[model samples]
Target chain A: MQLTGGQILCESLIREGVDVVFGLPGGAILPLYGTLPQYKDRIRHILVRHEQGAAMAADGYARATGKVGVCWATSGPGATNLVTGLACSSMDSVPIVAITGQVARPTIGKDAFQEIDVTGVTLPITKHNYLVMHASEIARTIREAFYIASSGRPGVVLVDIPRDVFQEKAEFGEYPTTVDLPGYKPVLDGNISQILRAARLIKEAQRPVVLAGHGVLLSRAMDELREFAEKTQTPVITTLLGLSGFPQTHYLSLGMPGMHGVAWASLALDEADLIIGLGARFDDRVTGDLKRFAPNAKIIHVDVDPSEIGKSVATAVPIVGDLKRVLKQLIANVEPAIHVEWMAHLDQLRREHPSLYIRPTEKLLPQYVIREISEVTDGRAVIVTGVGQHQMWTALHYTFKEPYTMITSGGLGAMGFEVPAAMGAQVGVPDRVVWSIAGDGGFQMTMSELATIAENNIPVKFAIINNNFLGMVRQWQEFFYNREYSASGYTKNPDFVKLAEAFGILGLRVTERSQVRDAIIKAMEWAGPVVVDFVVEEEENVYPMIPAGTSVDQLIEEPQMVEERR
Target chain B: MPKGPASHTIVALVQDRPGVLNRVASMFRRRGYNIVSLSVGHSEQPGFSRMTFVVNGDDHTIEQVRNQLDRLIDVVKVSDLSDENVVARELALIKVQATPYNRSEIIQLVDIFRANIVDVSPDSLIIEVTGDEDKVDSLLQLLKSFGVRELMRTGRVAMLRGANAYPGTPSANGNQ
Candidate 1:
């Protein structure tokens, strides 16, 4: 059938089973936007306030639904705005297919209005990118983009199309079921010999810890991970992005292991004899000083991306394959084993340093608020967060029982992630309760998305952890920089509740400790989007911290002055 | 696997497309891998380019370099020719200041090195030499004493001995 490139794009999206896309329309992209109405019934386009929000929302959707999230924007600033979101998705391995409209073919090199070398800018950040020269290549290019984005080691893929091409007519054929990419093969099955070696190592390991990461969620290998952990009787230590991949309440779960990670989890890793790194890169935050990082343990790194295998630490047995398939092979090859003494040791450490203990404070605490949210939702809601101390606190306190339940920017740590991402999550899974936990600073960065949320009535509960300071930075400054503050403190902050109200959403504020739970419940019950300004402790710091580039021995636990809250 | 930093040669078959070189160069720059020399040209297959990169790194770093290069979508296949029983050659054009007194002597040296005087000027002669890096280096060194005016060398390009080939190639694994 003869169709415009925009129609072909929409048709191909439908063929690829894309039900929704997050994007915004602009000058260069007018043709595609003009054609969007014809496919409105088949494809729902979410209009975001900023291009960055559109990309982030798409990322959120992908994380929540395990599908390639699609987003679109015009050229130049519109495409540039997506850089942060693309980088965030790339770092964390989220699958996203971002389309951008460029200036017409003739105007590309002439520096016409809204023209930019978008493909050039996003090249490093995306798994791959395409600059469509002809309208006929649109459908095929989009198919390839989606395929590359969702396939081996999922990541962001941008497809830049010239405006004239989108307006041009082309003979649209069947969307190719397969792409002939000679170099894009993803290793799905683990090498049998490597699996056998890993199995043998697991059997022989005395104190083994399973380092579960975002790959677990990406591969949906939670069941396999649980089975492996249980069969081998190993404790699972999750990374920040790996928060909800394993059930937090499970006896084997040691919670997150990183800078602001659980004290016992970090200690367990430090003391382990063998570490089974499942889809988790030994990031600096997780592994502190490499010289002192689990000096006794031999690492068995299992990742789909071969480049990630020994990028940081030395791998004893590197298994390059899909995590789920590798875990299956590992599960079948390995015999049931138990490390009774190791469990006892970890339990003792846990008892000595309770990870979830919040000191009772006169002022409302962010930890308390997060814990209350967890209680209110019964750990069933999809909890998303912007990066800050609040993100760490949420990971520490909130009980994540389901895979893909906790969504947050782990690698890029982009502050303005929560609002749009939560909206995307809610859109992706409409039945679930979506709570966006944001720090005061992070919330303000992307609070413009509040209008979009209200417009769609997305019902995303926004909880602003208001501390009047960039708490994480303030804590660092206090600990390292001699408390100079240095513009981290916000003196004249907008009333977040008022801001939400102005956006036509229900707004609530909770300052007193007794009001935290009620405010959360009120937001949850509200039919529309709700923003809760949780006025928390101004100087509170997330403890059990390993200062960056420092060894585990330099871990800072909560001060002895503050007693644990009940 | 070398214990210390050493020059490792990696050859990659990539799609002959725009920005492929930029992707490679960017990867090397961002990943902090030092590229000693790089040469790219059309390969035996149509729409494909072969790139030879001589990078300085230890075994682990070289592995990372190879893996990172292989990860690029445009790169069809990447093979490290460092450890292979392969034939490697580099072409260097050295312009030496040849005074009338030393002109015959330079000709004799070029003839001994199996090099050709491709271009000749009143004051200088451009000698083109194709050989291994060591031979090229030695030739350049000998010509330096004769006051080498300018020099340019194509980075080392290599191929496995006999029928030995990269995986997926027509001749690999005894495939006819």
Candidate 2:
């Protein structure tokens, strides 16, 4: 069929089975947007207020559906704005394809009106990128982009299309049935010997713990992981991105294990005879000090990315393959072993150093707010959180039964990720409820999306945990910097209720402890994008923090000076 | 990270495509991998480019740099040649500040190293030298005592001496 670059891009996206696109149109990207009407029946384009939100929305959608989420932006600033979202996705291995418009070929490097070397700028951050100089390359590039974005260890792929190229005529051909990337062949299955070795290690391990990660969800191997854990009777410790990868309420599930992880999980990691790391990188956040992390463990690391196999720690067994396939192979070859002593020790520790909640207080606390939301949603709502105290509160409190239900910026820890991601989640899973939990500082970072929510009528419920301070950073300052409080507290702030109201969305505020549930209930019920102002305690801290550069064992249970003052 | 900057020669085969070289170079620059020197050319394969780079970094940084390099889809394979017994050479054109008074001494020095004087001007002699990095560094160090005008090195290209890493290896020397 005869088609221009614009038509070809739209048709190619539809051919690739893309149902939704999140983006804001600009001058260079107008041609593609012009062709949107022709394919509107097959594709839905959500107009985000900012390109960053669009990119993040795509990321959210990808996280929820395991598809390559697509976003569009124009040249220069629009392209650069997607950098954060691209980097965030790359860090966390979420597959997203961000299409940006470029200046006409002739003026690309001449610093024309809206031209920047976006492909060059995004080189390090993206999984891969291409700048389309010809219209003929559009279809193949889109196919390749989606293929690259969704394959093993998925990541963001960007394609920059020139404006003139978008207007050029080309022949639209059939979509390639398979990717022709010879250089990108990821190992899909572990060697039999390695799988057998892993099984032997599991059977012999007296104090074994399975360190699960995002790869398990990425591979859709939750069942395999659960069965493997069940067959072996091993306690599972989840990384930040690995949350919801396992049923957190299961008997062997030891919530999150890292810097701010559950005390028992970290302790298990410290004392384990064998650490079976499944698709989890030994990220700095997960291992506070590398030298002291899992000192007693004979490590077995399995991941599709060969680079991550022995990058951080020396391992006894390194199996570089897809987590799903490796776990499946091991399940067939392995014998189930129960380490009663290990489970008992972990249970005893968990009971001894139980997670504490705020004592009965008149002031509405942040933890209570998150707990109440978890209680109401009950694994039905897809929870997205922005980075800060609220994010930790959500991770520690929420019990997500299914995989990929909790989407936060685990690797990059980017602020302002919640609203747009929640929008994408809601759009992807319209039948399910979507909640965006943001800190006061982070909520304002991308709150411009409130207009997007109102414009799209996205029906996303937002909970702004308003503490009037950058709570996390302030907590750090209070503990380490002698409480000088440099630029941590807000000198002035917008009233969130009024702000949401201004965007033409339902707005409510809960100032006292008694109003928490009712306010959340009101927002959940009145949902055409409702924002709840949760005015939480001004001075709250996420406790059991492993101070930076220290071992996991040396955690500060409570803020010293603050507790003394109290 | 180690105590001092460690130099490593990394050879990589990459898909020959538009902006691929820029992609590889930009990755190094962005990730703070200091490229001491680099050279690239078409390989034996029609659609592949072979790149050899001399990077200076600590142990940890270099490992990460190599990992990041290999992660790019264009990169077919990355091999670090630091510990391998290999044939390595670098070409350098050093124009030395030689005069009538010291021309003979410079000629002797060049002759001792078996370097060729490619061009001789009124006040300077351009000497072309090829050898390993240590020998190249020694000649340059020797020239430093004299008035060395300018120098340029084509960086280093290397191959395993006896046999390739595997059959029909992309690391073969047919492209050279």
Candidate 3:
């Protein structure tokens, strides 16, 4: 059948089983947008307030469903706006395909209105990118883009189409079953000898700890990870992104270990004899000083991405392959061993320095807010967060029971993520409760998406931890820069409840301590979308903290002055 | 930054693609590894190209770079030429300040290195030299004393001396 490039694009998406796409229309993208209506039944297009939101929502969708997310934008400004979101997705290994309209082929270099070298700009950030100069390349290019994005290590793939090409008629061909990417092969199966060597290491390790990371969720290898942990009786310490990889309530789960990690988790890392890094990169925040980090431990790193294997601390055993497959192979060959003493040691540490908050002085603590939310949701909601003190608070307080249940930007730490991302998560998993937990500062950055939420009618719960300050940065400044609060405080903040009301969401505020539970329940019962503005204690800092750039021993625990919180 | 020029030669096999070169160059740029010299051309394989570039970095930094480069989708295999005993050569075209006076002496110096006089003018002769960096460096040093006019050098292109090739190439198992 003869069809325009736009129709061919729709057909290609249909073949890929794409049910929904997020985007905004503009001058160069008009033709594709015109054809969008015809494929309305096949693909639902979510109109985001901005291109950044569209890209982030797509990322959120990808993370929630473990499927490649698709997003679109017009040329120039629209494409440029997507760069940040795409970069975040790239850094975090979320698979997303971003399509941008290009100025017509002839006008590409003429500095035409709304023309940009988007492919060139996005080259470094995206895993791969294509600029389709002809209509004939669209179907195959899109297919390749999707395949490349979703396979191997996931990342953003950009496809730029010139305006004229989208309208140009072209001959159609059967979608190729395979792409001839001669050099794109990824090692899926672990080398047997390497697996054996790693298994032996696990057997040998007396006080071993497993560092579970985002890759566990990406690979959906949490089950395998748990089995490996149980087989070896290893305690698990999750990275920030790896929060929900293993059940938070499981005995094996030592919780997150890092800069803002619980005292017990960080101590476990410091004291462990072996650290089996499962799908986790030993980022600087986690390993404060490389030489001092797990100084007594033998590191065994298992990850799908080969580059991450030795990028941080030198791994004694670096097994590069799919985590699920490698873990399976390992479980089959490894003999079960008991490390009761190590578990006892970890439990002792946990008891000694539990992540508890009873800051009696600070009336509405953020930790309290997270706890109440957790209490209301039963720790089962797909909780998403913008990067801040609140993110750490959520990680510290919330009880996550499953993989992919906690969605947050781990590596990039982009401020305004979860609002749009939570929407995408809600859209991806319609039956589940998706919550966007944002700090006041982060919420305002992309709060424009409140309109998008209203338009889509996506019932994503929004919990604004309205601290009236950039909490994380203020904490840093308070600790590091001698309390010089430079541009961190929000003196004249907008009334969040009124703002939510303006966006057609039932907005409720909980200022007093007694109002927390009632406000949460009321918002939870709201028919459609709800926003709860919990005006939390202004300066209640997240603790069990290793002051930035400090080693494990330098943890700033509870101070003696006044026994303030007690 | 004045980092000691720990010149390292890295040879990469990459699938020939429109922006592959830019991708490599950009990675180097991002890593703050200044490329000393770079050369790219078709490999023995049909659709693959070999790129050899020398960068200034310590061993740890270079290893990180090599591993990161291999992570790129288009890159097939990457090896540090300096790590292995290999056949290495660089081609240089040089124009020396030569008159009728002492012109034959310059030709003698070129001939000693097994170089060819690719071009000649009354005022100068452009000598083409192909050798390893040591040989090329020695020739350039000797010619500089004679007041060289201009010079251009390709970076080293390297291969294992005996029965070895890049991982997936036909001759990877053996030179044959």
Query: Which one is best on TM-score?
Result: 1
Tell me the lDDT of candidate 2. 0.86
Q: Could you give candidate 3's fraction of true interface contacts?
A: 0.41
Which residue pairs collide, candidate 3?
B163-B175
Q: A153 in model 2: Cα distance from truth in Å?
A: 1.1
TM-score of chain A of 3: 0.97
Model 3 scores what on Cα lDDT?
0.85
What does the lDDT come to for candidate 1?
0.89
Candidate 3 C-alpha lDDT tens digits along A371-461: 8889888889999999988998998999998678898888889989979899899999998988889989888989899899998788988
Judged by DockQ cut-offs, the docking class of candidate 1 is: acceptable
| TM-scores, each model vs. reference | 0.97, 0.94, 0.96
lDDT of 1 by residue, A210-275 (tens): 999999999999999999999999999999999899999899999998798998899988999999
Of candidate 2 chain A, the 10-residue stretch with the lowest lDDT total is A557-566
Best by DockQ: 1
Poorly placed runs, candidate 3 (over 4 Å): A559-566, B1-7, B56-59, B162-164, B167-176
Residues B39-123, candidate 3, lDDT per residue (tens digit)?
9999999989999888778766776777778777788877787767888789999989888988999999999999999888888
Better of 2 and 3 by TM-score: 3
